[model samples]
Target chain A: MNESERREAMRRGPLHGPDLTLNMRSDPRFLTGARGLIASVAEKIGLSSTSCAQVALAIDEALCNVIRHGYKKRSDAPIWVMVWVLADEGVGAGLRIVIEDEAEQVDPSKIRGRDLADVRPGGLGVHIIREVMDVAEYEMRSPVGMRLTLVKYDRPSPGVEPAAVGA
Target chain B: MADQPGLNVRMEQVGQAVVVTPEGEIAYTEATQFRQWMRKAHDASPERIVVDLTGIEYMNTPGVATLVEALQSAKKNKYRLVLAGMNTNVRSVFEVARLNTVFEIVQTREDALA
Candidate 1:
């Protein structure tokens, strides 16, 4: 899909489940609650336990970036989160989490994970988000701020044996 | 140190080492509290420090960053810092960052003490 088409798909989301929306303050205290909600929603949408945890972690990292870099630790700043359960044809089932913040915007193309060779703190958030989510996209919002959309499709491992029927 | 709502930290001295165990989530919300416990444990001036992560099932980049800071401090001060009892979820973050090779990690706290 082209850039505009992908953006439109993201905007429309999937029609499987009701979208969960949260407009929260940019405070660290809110992260735990948000993580719990995302994990629960991901699980309800048929994501595996591991995928649920990974999706939650990705959302947590995205919010942390908004609070730390975008808002510069300003607790009162506004941050919005929207979660959707995707069931696109051929793509199977998945979860999408979009985080928006009303803070200074930066070039999404320049938001690359730092080199891990240096072994430092503070720069691993982006890497974690990208690694956990199948699709990690960053874009500048109108007026001001940034938006990060992360999607993870449910792909069950074939190596694991299926649960015994009734036993 | 006292425990927060979502995170709790306990520290004890064992032989020549200080073991710090943190329970609950250690993401951005609790990283500062977890770091304070690490600081307190380091302040005791033990020959080694081992962080026992058995009770923690979820940890984010901030949590990993806090441990990294502790590791760097241990290196600068000529002391040993080890991590133990990381669940698969927590360990994956380390593996993704390729920090499994940088820090000393053990399967159990007893192994860390050893």
Candidate 2:
């Protein structure tokens, strides 16, 4: 999908309260706008600026990873992001974002952090995804595609825990 | 082989503070320009330095290292470095680096000045 088509796809998705789903056609602009929209939703739902920022950043990195490595240019790849508020006693209640991409399987074994001494710039996407969120999980779906889920602790204020009920 | 777009930096002064805004991706290919902007901001010796990042579209580790080094240089010079206007997409790069804590982040350039 192209930029306008991606935006239209997001618009076409179901919009029930507390959950938002966006679909983008593997476009470069998705990173920029997708991240922004997610943050806005989190903020509107009372996620602190920090937590909202965290989830947005992590998701952006995930999308960037998909574009940079997941598919050949102009392929029929599609990216999906599903987000909802999850209250976890472990994470102090935060936004849970699930990012899915319909691209070739990425060998998780090939994912590695760059050496601090080696000092390069472009290899940090996966590292950032793993570091920026409370929990990062990956799994391979049958037939195709990879799913990445990230959680952010969206506490309204510092040191205060909100009530969380399981989804 | 080097036909990629160049990273761009724009600046504005907030009282004694000078805010440097970088747009587009700041990767290995563009770290030099980022560093140059940071250096220029440092040499200006403003009472405070803030990087307005709402316009920054993407950054990577090498790009991040450049910011860390900038913060260190600012500290050595006894100037407080702050980051403001972080867009969610760009902020993700910092969070992955666990760098959100290392830098003083504010919501707006006005906040940084205040």
Candidate 3:
């Protein structure tokens, strides 16, 4: 295939993300805006500012991973991000989010958040997810994809045992 | 753009005021640094406090909570707290969390000058 022809074919592959979810875009600038959306939903669900912030950071990291590592530098690739505020229909009653991305399978065993001792810029995404959300699950989807579930409870973290509780 | 750390909350106590600046992302990982700075600033017993967020990059959930907690503590200690220099992202966070009504946000460091 010629260069132009290959480019057109890639464009035709998959450009549209799941319309069912909230505003999910590939633009990094819009990430701040997405976090804003999460914070709004979190407030309605009675999330503290800290919890809401964690949720924002967690979602930001997750989406970034999908866009960068998941999409493999493909501009036209699609990533699925869904938000379920006050959703209780799942196996357990709580706010849940299922983020599906069209990328290579992510091995849960190999995933580890950033370590506090290390001051690296990257590698902190997954760690933020695990620390912020009540629970985080990473696994492969049935048909052909990777799925990540993030859950949050309304209860305040009393005497919150903060991780890496030092500068 | 540079993926800078969300905040770099540095504190300096003036004669009767304190100034804080946050620089990087404030997710769960960086909340403790923020907490320490806040704890230290509160210990100074400033008559007025100004938090300058001009250089701040991004702030996650824990950061937001720390700010709220800081604001409340300032109020409790009879310190007039002024938060200024919010970028679009920071402003969006306050607006989303509905803290715009709870804190005093200004346009510049000059506005927060004691």
Best by TM-score: 1
Give stretches of model 1 more than 4 Å off: A1-18, A156-167
lDDT of 2 by residue, A1-167 (tens): 46556333333323454387898877764556787898887787677776776666667667767775777644357888888765444435566677788778866666666753443345666677666665576777557988776666653322223453332
Q: Tell me candidate 3's fraction of native contacts, as a decimal between 0 and 1.
A: 0.03
Q: Please give, for residues B15-110, the per-residue lDDT of candidate 3 as tens digits.
A: 788887777666544666777887788888888778888877776545666777787787777888888888776676556445677788899988
Model 2 lDDT tens row, B2-69 = 22364678877878898898877775456677888888898898989999877776665557878888
DockQ of each: 0.87, 0.21, 0.06
User: Which consecutive 10 residues in model 2 chain B have the weakest lDDT in total?
Assistant: B1-10
TM-score of chain B of each: 0.97, 0.88, 0.88
| Candidate 1: clashing pairs of residues | none
Taking chain A of model 2 alone, its TM-score versus the true chain A equals 0.73
Tens-place lDDT per residue, model 3, A39-88, is 67776677766667667767877876776677764556566667665433
- TM-score list, all predictions: 0.89, 0.56, 0.50
Off by more than 4 A, model 2: A1-18, A73-76, A88-91, A155-167, B1-114
Candidate 3 local distance difference test against the native: 0.66
